[model samples]
Target: MSVVAERPVVAEESRAVRWWRRPWVGPLALVVVVFVAVSVPRYLTLDPAQSLVPPVEGFAPYYPMLVAHVLFGSVAIVSCCFQVWPAFRRRYPVAHRWIGRAYVFAGVLPAAVLATVIGAKSPFGPVARVSNVLLGLVWFGCTLAGWRAGRARRFGDHRKWMVRSFVLTISTVTNRVWGVVAGVVLGPQLETTFGGNEQYMTSTIAGLTTWLGWVVPLILAQLWLDRRPKKRARAAGRSGVPA
Candidate 1:
């Protein structure tokens, strides 16, 4: 009798497991968590003096609105970390639906509204003010579009719009990162060019980064979304499958 060689068995990974293992997911989630941890504590004290932005003249509600915006934005960002997680969505679809509702209603909606109000009176100068207002509106619009797409059972469009919304939601974190970088690079020039006006220096950096933070990432996201179909078609062709 001839001895037949047996093939080694390799268990296939589940879809959820595969998605969880994607390189970007864990690190991105961790970054968002770290951002929340670092950025939220000051606001939690509810002291107006602890506010990041200076109070605008005659705007008594500025601090209150800032506090609300930060808290609600924290909710939106934290919840959205899971919202974009394919593993979580694939494994617990029911929970996903509920979380999506929370993300929309309890997080983005309120946060965006307050953001718009706060942005309108921002002390970061006209450029920063316009950037903030536009960011708020676009963020709100993307989230609303995502929710409507889901309601209409257009999962693909829903995913795209949600991804856009989430990117906008996290732009604040990006803004801070950009601000720090710009400060480091620009700090030495403050004495020479800005006449030691820290507020002016800060406003300049904030204005530039506020635009960069959302605009750059948003462009990259749109490019990715546009290319995704081409990538799929290529893969399908390689596999002799119809896309």
Candidate 2:
């Protein structure tokens, strides 16, 4: 009857008819990029001295650790891509279910390893340690929360948390994206700021942005998506979508 009354119907129908631009594609491309940019090179070239961070306790004998690192990194990269299937795309609960388990083991687990590998460099400034710890917590916390929410049969909450987790996990891929940009743009200034590890810092900054950029934005997105305007649900039911 009014513009307000007509607005939602138009929005909903428009949303339903859309294609060619699903949210999953961005992350899918990210997964591929991670493999190409980070994983492949790290694998083909196994030099402990060249590793971006110091070796962990078990990750010593850099060769083996590097191999494992590449392996796990691959898992985290791939897992984050499939983590969001049922929503905004054709539902693939069957793949999502199995992939969900692998994600926890692959994606979240390797991140835990990175936490150790990258240890707290408090003297090097808070960014490295803080980022490492926070990244691990985000990866673990989000995945766990998503799992628990789904187990409780709260689908909406589950989806939101899972999206949050996947966003955090994808920071690995995002790190590379930012790393290249910063190095290309700030190549000379890096040695001045972080000593000689300018490229390393660029990479680190990129990885961290995956959290600062994608994950945080995702949380804001969830809040925005969840904010139903209070009246929309009732209106949707009245308009025949059955809420």
TM-score of each: 0.91, 0.65
Any idea what lDDT model 1 has?
Answer: 0.88
Off by over 4 Å in 1: 1-13, 16-20
lDDT of 2 by residue, 60-142 (tens): 45456446656665666676665654343344666777777777776576655655445343223456556666666666777
lDDT tens per residue, model 1, 183-203: 899999999989999989988
lDDT of each: 0.88, 0.63
Clashes found in each candidate (C-alpha, N, C closer than 3 A)? 0, 2
The TM-score measured for candidate 2 stands at 0.65
lDDT (0-100) at residue 31 of candidate 1? 94
What local lDDT score does residue 24 receive in model 2, on the 0 to 100 scale?
A: 57
Cα deviation of 156, candidate 1, in Å: 1.0
TM-score of 1: 0.91
